[model samples]
Target: MIALVGLGLGYMTPTVVFDTFGIVSDTTGGAVPSAYVLALVVMALTATSYGKLVSVFPSAGSAYTYVREAMHPNLGFMVGWSSLLDYLLLPMVNALIVKLYVEQVFPTVPSWLVVVVYTVCTTTLVAITMRGTSRVNLVLLAAAITVMAVFVVIASYQLLQGEGAGTLVSTRAFAGPETTLPLVLTGATVVCFSFIGFDAVTMYAEEAKTPRTLPRAIMLTVLLGGGIFLVAAYVTQLRFPTNAPFGEFTDDPLPQIGHLVGGPLFQALLVGAAFVATVASGLASHASVARMLLVMGRNGALPGRGLRWINPRTHTPVVNIIIVGAVCLLAVDFSLELISACINFGALVAFTFVNASVIAHFAVRRRELRTAGEWVRNAIVPGVATLMTVLLWTQLHSDALIAGGVWAAIGLTYLLVYTRGLRRPMASLEE
Candidate 1:
C-alpha cells in the first residue's frame, strides 16, 4: 500500500507545479487554485470507480480489464488503445517539460536537441535495467515535496509582506476578474494531468495484501496528491494572482515564480527538482510503456513481429524501448498545452469507460441494483463519475479530440483487420 501510494503520486509527474503551472494558471485566468479544486473533485470521484473495479477484477490491466469484462470486448480494446495516448505520451510530456527547463539554462540550444538527448538518455537507462528506480523516484518525490513546501513558505512570506496580492488569503486566488465556468472547466481539464496516477494504483491490485487495501490506496493517493497540488497552487496563486507579470513565460512559469520568491539560487534549486522529476517519471513510464506495447504485441492487438526482440545481454525488449523513445521525439514539435490536452483526451476516455463498466458489471450484469444500498454503490456513484468525466471531456481542445480520435480510429482499423469481425478471442488482458 505504501509503495502504491508512492507510485501513484510519483506518476503524477510532481514537477507539473513548475512545468505546466503557467499554462494552467493562464488557462484559468489566474484562477489556478480553483482549477485544481475542480480537478480534485472530478478525480476524487473517479477514484471511487477505480477502487471498486480493482476489488472485483484484482489484476493489472486497469481500465482495459474492467471494461472488457463488464462491457463489450471491442469497446474495451478502444479504451485500451485510447489509453496508449496517456501512457505512451507521458514520457514525451516529461521530455517536453525537460526541454522547457533546459532551454532556460542554455537559451541557444535547439528545443529538438534537448528532447532528443533527454529521450535517448532515459530510453537507454530503461532499456538496460530499472534497478533502484523506486528508491530513486522516492528520493526525487521527497525532494519535490521539500521544494514545494519551501516555495509555499517563501511565497507566503512575500504575500504577507505585501509583495504581490497584498493579503495571503483572498477570493482572488481562486477566481480572477475574467474567470468563468467555461474557463475554469478548461483549466480543470488541464490540471487533470496532475491526477493521472490515481487510477494507476489499480495496476497493483493483485499484489495488494487484501482486496480492500488497493482501493484504500487509490483514494489515499488521490487525496494526498490533490492536497499537495491545492496547497502549492493556492500559495502560488496568491503570490501571483494573474499572469500579467508572466508576459512570455505564461506556459512555463516555474522559472519566473522561483526567481521572484527565492532568487537565482532557489530558481536553480526548483529547476533541479523539476529535472529530477522528469528523469524519474521518464524512466519509469518508458519501461512501463515498452512492456505494455509488448503485451499488446503478444496479444496480436498491435504488430507483434518486431516487438518480441529482446536484447541478448540486457534481456530487455530493446525494440519496444526504442519505439517508446521514438514516440517521445514527437515532443519536439508539440506545445505543452496541445500535448496536455491530447493526453487528457485519452485519460478521460479511459475514465469514461471505467465508470460505465461499473454500471454494466453490477447494475446490468449482476442485477444488483434492486437493493437501495446496492443501487447507491453500484449505480449512483459510478453514474455521477461518468457524468463528471463527460463534463471534462466536453471541454477538451478540438485538436486533442482530433488527435485522440485519429489514434482511436487507427486502433479500430487494426482491430477489425486482426480480429476479422470479432469471431476470434484475443488473449486476456491479465496476461
Candidate 2:
C-alpha cells in the first residue's frame, strides 16, 4: 500500500498536476501551491472517514461492502463500478508515463513498442501475482521505498548545498494576474488527482491476511505518500523553479535532480530507481483490480461463474487479471493526461461515496455519540472534496470530460443490465 501510494503520488502528483494547472489557467501564479495545500487538507479530512470505514469492513471489496452495509445494494454496485474504472485506468496512466520516459531516453524508439513492452512487463507481473498478493505486495513495498529513499537522499543533498529547501519556505510571487476564485478551485481539483491512489490500500481488504491491520496500513500509506509528494514538489520547485513542461521533462526529473545533487551515475540510479517504483506500483494495481473484479463476479453482479475462474495452479483470478490487463493495454492508445483524468474522476467519485457512507453508517448507531463524530469526519469533508472534484471535472477540457462521462454512462448501463438481466433471474431461480 505504501509503495503503491508513493508511486501514485511521486509519479502522478507534482509533475502532471502542476502541468495541468499551469495549462488551464496559464498561471505559474501564487495559487498553485495553495491549491495543492487545499487538496491535502481536503484529502486528510476524507482519509479520516475512509480510515474508519476500512477499520469496520476489511473485506476485499472495500467500498463494495461499505456502500452495501452503509447505504443500499445499488449504491454498493455504483461504488464498485467507479472503483473498477479507477483501477482499470491507472495501469494505462502508469504505462503511458513509462512510455514517455522511454521516449526521452531513446527518442528513436517507436511509441507503440514502448506500449507493447509495458504490456509485456505488466502481464509478467500479473503472472507472478498468481502466486499470492502478499508476495507481490512485499516486493512492491520494497521497490517503492527504495526509490523514495533515493529521492529523499538526492533532495537532502540538494538542500545541504543551499539549493532545494527554499521553495518549501518561500511562497511564489504573483502580481497583475487576475487570480480568480474559479481558477483556484479548478487548480485544486487537478491537485486532487495527485492524491488519488492512496485508496489502493482499501481495495486489498479481502486478501489482506488480516483485515483489522488494513486501516492502519491504509492510513500510514496516505500519510507517508502525501508527505513524500509534498516534499518532492517543494524540492522540485527549489531545484528547478521553471515549472518546465512535463512533456519536456518526461524522461525523469529525479535524474536531473540527481545530476544537480551528484552526477551521471547518480542520475542513472534515480532512473533505475523510478523503474522499480513503477513496477511495484504496477504490480500492486494489477492484484487489487483483479480481486475487485473477482469479488464482483462472485457476488453475481457480473457473470460470476466464468469471471471467477481462478488458475488451478496458482489460485489467482486468472480471467479477471487478463481482462484488466487487456483494458489497460487498450487505454495505452490514449494520451497520458487523458488516462490520468479518467482515473482521477473515478477515484474522486468513489471517495465521495465512501465519505457519505461514513455518515450514513454512523448515523444509525445508537451506542455512542462517537458515531456523530465519525459522521462529521467521514461525511462532511468528503462531501466538500466531492464538490471540488466535480468542479475540477467541469474545468477539464470538454473532450476529456466527455470521454469520462461516456465511460461512466456505459458503466451505469452495465449495472442496469446486470440488475434486470442477471440478478432478477438469479433471485427467481433461488425461489
Candidate 3:
C-alpha cells in the first residue's frame, strides 16, 4: 500500500498535472481532458502487463530483471541502460521543476541558486536512510493529495457558480473544434510521462512482505493514480476553458488557478504543497535509481563495489545516491522540455520491453498455461500494450528519439566490448 500510494502520488507531480495542460493543448488544440483519458487507458493496459511480470519474478530491477529472465541478458542490459535515462534524470527533472516554481513566487531570486539548494537538500534526505525517506514521502504525499483535493473542490464550486466557463457542463475540454486523432495521440504520448512511476512498484518486490500481492498493488496504483489525474485535468480544464491557451500560464498554472478560485493565500498554499510534492518525488526517484544501480553493480553489469556499497548504519546505497546528486547538477543547464522528453523516451522504451517480457515469460518460454484466461492475461493483453507503447514511441519528439538512440548505441557498444562479442554470457562480471 505504501509503495502504491507513493508511486501514484510521486508520479502525479503538480508540474506534470498543471504543465501537461499546456503541452496537450498545444498538440491537440485544447483536447487536454481527452488526452489524459487516452493516456490513462494505455497506462492501465501496460500496468496490467506489469502485474503479470511481477507475479512471476517477484524481484527487483524492474524491466531489467523481467527481460533478463524471460529473454536474454544482453537485451536486459539494453533495457537497464535505457532505464538509466529515466531513473537517473527524473530527480534532476523534479529539482528543475521545483526551481521553476520557486522562481515564480520569488522572481528576484536566481534560478541557479534554487536548483543548487534543492538538489543538495533532496540528495541529503535520500542519502540518510531509506526508512527516513519513506516516512517523509508519506507525509508529503498526504499533503499533496490534500492540496489536489482542495483544488478540485474549489474549482468545481467555481465552475458551478459560472466563474470561468459560465457553465458547469461542457464538451469543449474533451472534444474541441480543432481536435484530431493524431493530435490526441500526440498529447497521449506526452501525458504518458505522468504514469512513469507505476513500474517502480515492481522494483520494490524484494522488500515487499507479501511478494505475490505485488501484481494487485501495481494495478491498483495505476487505477487510483489515473483517477486522480483524470479528475484534476478535467476540472482544471473547465476552470481555464478551451479558448484560453495554457501556454501563458505554463510556468505555474496550479497556483494561477488557485489564485483564481480562492485568493492569494490559497495560491501560496498550493505553491508550498507543490514544492513538498516535488521533494517527495525527488526522494523516491533518487532511491529508485540508486537501487537499480546497486542491482546492476552487484550483478557485475556496472562498476561493482562502488555503486553496490551500502552504508551499514543507514542501510542505504550512499555512493549511488551521491552519483545521482552529481548527475542532478547537469539539470541546471538543460531546459525542462529537453529533460522531460529524454526521460519520457527512456521510460516508454523500457515499458515496451516490459510488455514484451510478459509474452516471453508465459507464452513462448514456459508454455505451461493452457487456459483461455491465461492466454488473455499473458499474451493478448501484453500484445495490445506493446502495440500501444510502440505507437506512442513513434509520436515522441525527434530530440527524444535521437537522444534515446544515442544512449542505446552506447549500451550496445559496451555489451560488445564487455561480453567479448557475445561469445560468453553477459553476466561475465558476476564471475
Question: Against the true structure, what is each candidate's TM-score?
Answer: 0.94, 0.81, 0.95
Off by over 4 Å in 2: 1-32, 130-168, 173-181, 244-263, 364-397, 421-431
Better of 1 and 3 by lDDT: 1
lDDT of 1 by residue, 221-255 (tens): 99999999888888888888777776788888777
Candidates 2 and 3 compared by TM-score, better number: 3
lDDT of 3 at 283: 87
Q: Rank the candidates by TM-score, best first.
A: 3, 1, 2
Better of 2 and 3 by lDDT: 3
**Tens-place lDDT digits, model 3, residues 1-431:** 76555765675564467755665666788778898898888888888888888887777898888888788998899898998898888889887877777766788998888888888888888888776887788788889889889888888888898877766578877877788999999888888877778888877888889887788888787887788888888887777765354346664465566676778898898888887888888888888898899989889888658888989988899999999999888767786767777888888888899899888888898884699898898888889989998998899889989998999899889888988998765672232
Q: How much is the lDDT of residue 6 in candidate 3?
A: 72
**Model 2: colliding residue pairs:** 59-206, 60-206
The true-versus-predicted C-alpha distance at residue 38 of model 1, in Å, is 1.4
Compose the digit string of candidate 2's lDDT tens values, residues 1-431. 44334433433333333224333223334345555666677677667667788787766676766777677777787777877777777666666766655665568998888777877777766755544544554555565556556666676666566763343355542211455666666556656666766676676555557666666666665566566555555545555544353335532344455455557676666555565555555666776778778777777766657677888877778778777777766744676556666776777677777777776776555322356665455555656755655555566545656776787788778777867743542211000
- Return the candidate ranking by lDDT, descending: 1, 3, 2
